[model samples]
Target: MSAQAVDGLSRRGLLKFSVGATAFLATAGVTASLSGCSSSDTAPGFDALRTSDLPFLLAVIPVMLDGALTGIPSQSATERTLHGLDSGLSHLSPEMLKLTRQLFDVLGMAITRGPLTGIWSPWENAEPGQIRHFLGRWENSSLELLRQGHSSLLQLVLMAWYSQPQSWAGCGYPGPPKI
Candidate 1:
């Protein structure tokens, strides 16, 4: 309990050890949960994403691409965005796909999800305001992982939404040059 030493460890060393141990345990727990289910247990879907992940993306697309998605019916826009995201994900390298899958798994978990995303509700129940706040936090977070997650999601959503012909007019592209 003294600041000088505890057992054989200096107080500073002991504090460091405790922090490291806690982080290791937390990471192990998350990895175990993510790997607990076999591939066959997952609902069938795109090459990169499980069926459960689609709902999360559905919730995110409109919030991230609000301008492009405006005036488009929610259901149809969500469906098209999902398709575009899947197509884009399919072309990623295996390493990138693996990383993306891990990100989705973390977001899917109730434990890590709340702390990381600040959205305690399931994707379906999450309000657009809550999702937007979470996105903003991640985008502006000092942590590298949070920033990377925000970047990845934003890039994927923007690419998927803007690639559509319907979105072309929003940016004034006027359809693939006269070729």
Candidate 2:
């Protein structure tokens, strides 16, 4: 075929495309630069605002944890709450949609495949320290990968977090306990 066809998506073409994509984003804007978010208001250099905003916390938590699960279905509130959110969030950006697919698959496996025999999620052993460690590590990696701007996949993830409204109450997170 004289290498004229296949639109260069052949192995050689893919390599070329990858290199071009990386260089383009590297030379792109600084909006792509990001930093990890600390877990609580009490954390050093953390934001003290929004302690009352339960929904915001929930919306942010899973993303802070795994760089995904920003759109998981809820079981925390009444059926009506679930129904309302189900309709409103019926469509997510392609990136969030992809993460939703991944999380749902994990949920399905955890349910059907049964625990211990199913995939082992580090979260299963979560204590405050362990959760903090995992969340910090994931967010650090997410932001670092984002700042590098050489990988399309992590940039897509950053978009998913930024594009969504950071409100968990809308997703059925009731207000947090009074301290």
Root-mean-square deviation of every model? 5.6, 17.4
Tell me the spans in candidate 1 whose CA falls farther than 4 Å from its real position: 1-34, 37-45
Per-model C-alpha lDDT, please?
A: 0.72, 0.35
- In terms of TM-score, how similar is model 2 to the real structure? 0.26
Q: What are the per-residue Cα lDDT tens digits for candidate 1 across 69-150?
A: 5467767777777778888888999777767766776776666668777888888888999999999998887555668888
After superposition of all CA atoms, the RMSD between model 2 and the true structure is 17.4
Off-target runs (Cα >4 Å) in candidate 2 are: 1-88, 93-95, 103-124, 142-179
lDDT of 2 by residue, 73-120 (tens): 433222223233333334556565433333222222323213311223
Model 2 Cα displacement at 13 (Å)? 23
- lDDT of candidate 1 at residue 130, scale 0 to 100: 93
For residue 152, give model 2's deviation from the true position in Å.
Answer: 14
